[model samples]
Target: MSTSDWLFLILQFFAFSFLAIGGAMTVASDMHRVIVDDMGLLSNNEFVTAIALGKISPGPNVMFVAVLGYQVGGLFGALVLTLAIILPSTTLAYYVAKWGQFNQHRKWVVAIKAGFTPIVVGLLFSTGWIIVDGFHSMKAWILGTLVMLLVWRTRVHLLILIGLGAILGMLGIV
Candidate 1:
């Protein structure tokens, strides 16, 4: 990639880092737009696979940025995008945590927390919907719905659910 391409990649991730309210997943649709739709850096399948890989990994979901970077460039791209996406958000989270602790009893703080709860929930729902939309099979839809129901109504461990999903995938059931 050229210097300008590298700069744009870094800047785009940096901007998305700040917009990642609730979580990095919250900005996924915008990331899809910029990386796949606008820049054509990755195709639809590539983008969806990146997200799936990131979600299955042990670290933060923001790892999708690293996957995108690697897809666009290489190792350097991965490192640059990961750092760009993390730095601003990590710093802001630290200071905000301090502020929140100090102002825990304030009415505005409580109100802000209350207001953000629904927004975060909605963002999470949207993220799930986006992922689900990528699956083209009715079997996948049924399995996903069953998994969602299990998560909402039962006390089963999440890793077990994930394992079950993986098994289904391996058996070509979903």
Candidate 2:
């Protein structure tokens, strides 16, 4: 990549980091827009695959950002994007957490927390919608609904669902 491309990548990720109010997952749709639609750095299948890999991985779901960076510009790109996405959020979270803790009893703080709850939930739902929409199949829709219902009603482990989904994918079930 050229110097300009690297700069744009870092700047984009840094901006995205701040917009990740609920979590990195919240900004996933936007990432798809930029990475796949706007920049054409990755195709839809590749984007979905990256997200699946990130979800199946043990650590933070935000690992998809690294996957995107790698797809865009290899190892160094992964490092740059990961740091860019994490650093701002981490720093802001640290200070805000301390402040929230200290002012836990304040009415405004409580109101702020309550106000953000629905927004966060909505953002998360949008993320799910974006991922599921990529499949473009009725079977995928039905399976997703079933999995969601199971997650909501049962004590089944998520990893088991992921494993089942993987098997279904391999068998061309979804």
Candidate 3:
């Protein structure tokens, strides 16, 4: 990639960092749009693979940003992205959390927390949709829907769900 493209990705990542309400995953769709659709830095499959790699082999799912950076710009890219994703959000969250602890019972604070619930839910849904959006088959749609339902409605273990998915994929069921 050109220096300009690297600069663009870094700047976009920094922007996403602040809006990562629930987590970095919440901003995955935006990342997909900019990185894959708008900038053409990576293909959709590569982007999805970064997410998968982050989730499956991770200290945190947020590490997916590192994968995206690495794909685009190697080790330096990874380090820069790691910082971009963490620094602003971490600093913001730290201050916000401290403020929240002090004002935990205030009406505005309570309202703000309540207000974010639906937003976080919507963001999470969008992120999931972005991941599922890649698969076009009816079977894939069904499986994706089933997983979404399981996640949204039930208390089932995520690992079990992941394992089940892996097994089904191995058997060519989904």
TM-score of each predicted structure versus truth: 0.72, 0.69, 0.63
- Please write out the lDDT profile of model 2 over residues 31-149, one tens digit for every residue: 88888888788899989988899987889899988998898889987898999999998999999999999999899999999999999899778888887988899999999999989
| Candidate 1 structure lDDT | 0.87
lDDT of 1 by residue, 28-59 (tens): 89889988898888999998998989988988
Candidate 1 backbone collisions, by pair: none
**Cα lDDT of model 3 by residue, 1-174, tens digit:** 888877888888889999987789889999999989998889999999999999888398999988988998899988998899899999988999999989999999999999999988887788778778777778888999998899889999998998998999999998
Candidate 1's displacement at residue 53, Å, is 3.1
* Candidate 2 Cα outliers beyond 4 Å, as residue runs: 1-12, 21-58, 68-74
lDDT of each: 0.87, 0.89, 0.89
**Candidate 3 regions off by >4 Å?**
1-13, 19-52, 55-61, 71-76, 122-126, 145-156
> Which candidate, 1 or 3, has the higher lDDT?
3
Candidate 1 vs 2: which has more TM-score: 1
Highest TM-score against the true fold, candidate:
1
Clashing pairs in 2: none
